[model samples]
Target: MADTVADLLIDRLIDWGVDTVFGLPGDGINGLFESLRRRQDRIKLVQVRHEEAAALAACGYAKFTRRLGVCLATSGPGGLHLVNGLYDAKSDGQPVLAITGHTYHDLIGTRYQQDVDLERVLGDVAAYSERVMSASHVCNVVDEAVKTAIARRTVAHITVPKDIQDWPSSGPRSKANVARHSGDLYADAMPLPPQSALQKAADLLNSGSRVAILAGRGCLTARKELLAVAEKLGAPIVKALLGKAVVPDDHPLTTGGIGLLGTAPSQEVLEGCDRLLIAGSSFPYLEFYPRPNQARAVQIDLDPSRIGLRYPVEIGLTGHCWDVLRGLLPLIEDKSDRSFLTQAQQRMAQWNELMETRATRNDLPMKPQVVARTLNEFLQDDAVICCDTGTVTTWAARHILIRGAMEFSASGTLATMGNGLAYSIGAAVAFPGRQVVCFAGDGGLTMLMGELATIAKYRLPVKVIVIKNNQLGMIKWEQLAFEGNPQYGVQLQPIDFAGVARACGVPGWHLADPRLARGVLKEAFDQPGPALVEAEVDPNEPPLPGKLTTDQAWQFVKALAKGQPDRWDIIRTVVENKIREVV
Candidate 1:
């Protein structure tokens, strides 16, 4: 007898270097369930309570390993739930394949139970969406699904009909056949230009008095070459959010992040430089670019289209960052003195020093910066951090130092609100060896509270730390700045997140003292699993990502003295590098 379709698919997954697929099972995909059961030794299956967790777990694996992530789901609502995660993968350029089950091929148009159109639901977020309508189409569709995911570096949906999974296939069922990609597809892949372009790029740098490199995610593959090129050229490197791991954060030329919530050193360099070298970052938001025509720009990217997409470019070179950089390294003239580079490095050093001083400052209402550092101190390098959307994101983005050992995962682009708990579950389950932490706000946790059951049922070691400020913090701050003041409904009713954790077979911690935070954090991190450490920070705290308006400023003067800033009661509002401790 010929091999079954499930056997064929399993073989392909093994071929693609995938050993595990995350998802909960249902009757709709029984053939796959049985196939997975048989290959228990070769290709294991992790059953999650929610499809969302499964997708997110796949995202974590992809991010942590730089491999194509794989997840599975049954039909209808299960498939719909995967959309949010697929969007995350797509926007962030994570390679992940979402294999979902649909109704029998014949029953597709009849609107049977769990009959939603899988292709239509996922088309917006996925790089490619396909349905296995015929037994003959299985091999082709499966091959395309895996290849598309890698080539596009995004999520793709392969809807395997229930009927097809059990059908007979002409194969030995050894787990290697299903995963092989057609050879020709990868043949036309672009090759990088040689030393010619690098020499030209180096000439511009040699002529310029001051230059800096602004990097993005695209630099990951060629991080070493890019670093060498930057070093040889004496350029300070500034990263976008996606560019975090490109260079070691402790590197001398590293200027930190650049954007709306960017660090001061990055802004100072980008705004004031004579030449700005852009590489591998599309940086969708144009606001992140410097003042109009402020600096001459040179960009190098793999995709030709992205070169001038944001800012006007004086020099645009399209090639692989590694290849181009290796060539450029030889051509760059080493200067006798790097005075310009030294000044930029010093600015970054001051920023780092001030950042540490302010973040560790002891104050009444706990500072977010302090809170993040405490967590960082309490956790090990292998621990996982899943940060939430708003101000919490800024704190984690800026302060949470990611050593090479730890798994630092986040929803980068989509910036969805309810992802904190969900993403944490995914990260924890994806890497069972690591301690997983969710840095979320009260509002974001409430949105996906049901996932608490997902954690309790599986007993995953994912901790949730909620900031219980009882306000729509980011929203309230924006309204106060634009509309003149915080509005109604922005004030949230207090919920005992810690109590809820305790009720769900998990321990809880609630703390307000900044000094005592490390102890509470240690207790929470040290505890078994599934916990919440709620911090009762003042809702109107941190004049942080929180902005004050002209009226609020006037009110601050009317309420207090002339030199004092608007009081949030969290800490003194300061734009300088350090956080000032409130007396």
Candidate 2:
């Protein structure tokens, strides 16, 4: 019989194909930590400086390796710190397992010293959240949670109650769980829409004065087929940020992407279109959207719940994106209109060129845009880039130049920080030989730095490039743009990330010349063990989070003086510059 709860967990994890667990050890989790010490081969645990880094590392693992990522945290505040990272796994559709310890069963409802309601806390951010209510539930729940995480491509939360975790499971635990058989959970698909509905949609697409298609994350499965449909209809497709990779960027029918902070050309084209075919997307921004009376809309989706969620739909077809699109393609008469696609491309090129020009301007401490562009040139196509949330996200979106070679992973929906480090850990573990580069901010790194130890323990070759800007950049930018508050809590004293990595046993390097970045990046990837590459960066820089106007800033100042700023007042700012968000 296994002597400890840690042994039981290790046994289950081995069956789940998890060779490594990225995290730190602490007092609250001492029992499990000790158990891990007993069997170092099956489950190699990574100890990092912060929980956020562990989660970020896990995010990378799931995205690059096409496998479930796992991260561990202790009870109370230790576990609470993983919320940002867990949300990253949730919103980005990464299969991640978040296992956290809970205070002993004896402390239930007694206001235990280190207890937080983890189940409820993880509920909104996780696809599945459950507590090991009893030791009997452990083996089954663990297996099932891992399956659901992979099958659903979302994060699963499993809280291990402290006491029973160490309690024997009554017999030798088996490797299989009821969940191992969870394959293609959805069996019966929604029936096809009526013939009249398809005909009406066909007729509308054929006769509409202006036509376009908007695709979202829901279209991931139907991507290639939908691309065919768009081409046949002469429809220019606009993608939600989450739908960025659905239709290959090189496809001619691809017009531009949509949302707040989205491209100006895309928004203009969408506004001008008379008929908009919504495909697999429930894009959140509604105000920029025209009145229902403006565009005749038709939507096709697998989930009936999304049929009419965003805007009113003329035809709400409850079917998979590809299946519905296949029928729609045959009915859609080819049109010669290339005006929308052309106009958008022209604008995209002009703006893209303009931004590219500004990104390379040499300045002291180095502009992040310059770093992003320069790094992209050196990184191989197979490299995986995990960017932190901050001004760096904006720079990366504009400069990283995703040409299909690299798979980009970031917290798109939750827009959380501290994911750069944690997600990279997972990415490295998932693809041991592939290059994993984490673009992190100093502030974001501190939140998950403890994962450095995790990297050392596992000896996973994950390289982190810390953009050492001494501030909570996104918050500072927000305060400067909207609040007009002289950066308050946003300022941070810089920490030598390279020094920290050395202290943790991972080799470290500090580089200022981007020309040298290529060499250093190559060496790090070639290095047999984990490494950290810290680059000093400018902090006053901004991702320009949700742009605001001068007028809005003045109003916010007055509101601060007057003690109140309404919602519309804040919206006014985000509208002016129109920031584009990339997931």
lDDT of prediction 2:
0.70
The TM-score of candidate 1 is 0.85
Please provide TM-scores, in order, for all candidate models, with all chains considered together. Answer: 0.85, 0.78
Pairs in clash, predicted candidate 1: 11-175, 11-176, 12-178, 12-179, 358-579
Which run of 10 residues does model 1 get worst, by summed lDDT?
574-583
Query: In each prediction, how many residue pairs overlap at the backbone (N, C-alpha, C within less than 3 A)?
Result: 5, 37
Q: Mind giving the per-residue lDDT tens digits that candidate 1 earns over 398-460?
A: 787766555555677787777778777667666778888888888888877767777787788
- lDDT tens string, model 2, 1-583? 4665556666677776787777767666776777777768777777766776667668767766767788888887778888877777776678889888888878866898777888888888887888876444566677778877876678998887677667764544335534334332323434687777888988888887577888876676677778787777667777776566566544566644565335565676687888888987767778545566888889987667778887887878877677788778788887787676677677777656655665665555555666677676656667777777877666665566555555666677777777776777777767777777788888877876777777787776777778777778677656645666545676688788889999999999887764566677667656777788787765534454222446656844554454333334334433422343220
Where in model 1 is the C-alpha error above 4 Å?
A: 1-3, 170-190, 221-223, 317-320, 381-384, 404-407, 429-436, 450-463, 482-485, 528-531, 543-583
Q: Which candidate ranks first by TM-score, i.e. highest?
A: 1
Task: Indicate the TM-score of model 2.
Answer: 0.78
Tell me the whole-model lDDT of each prediction, alpha carbons only.
Answer: 0.74, 0.70
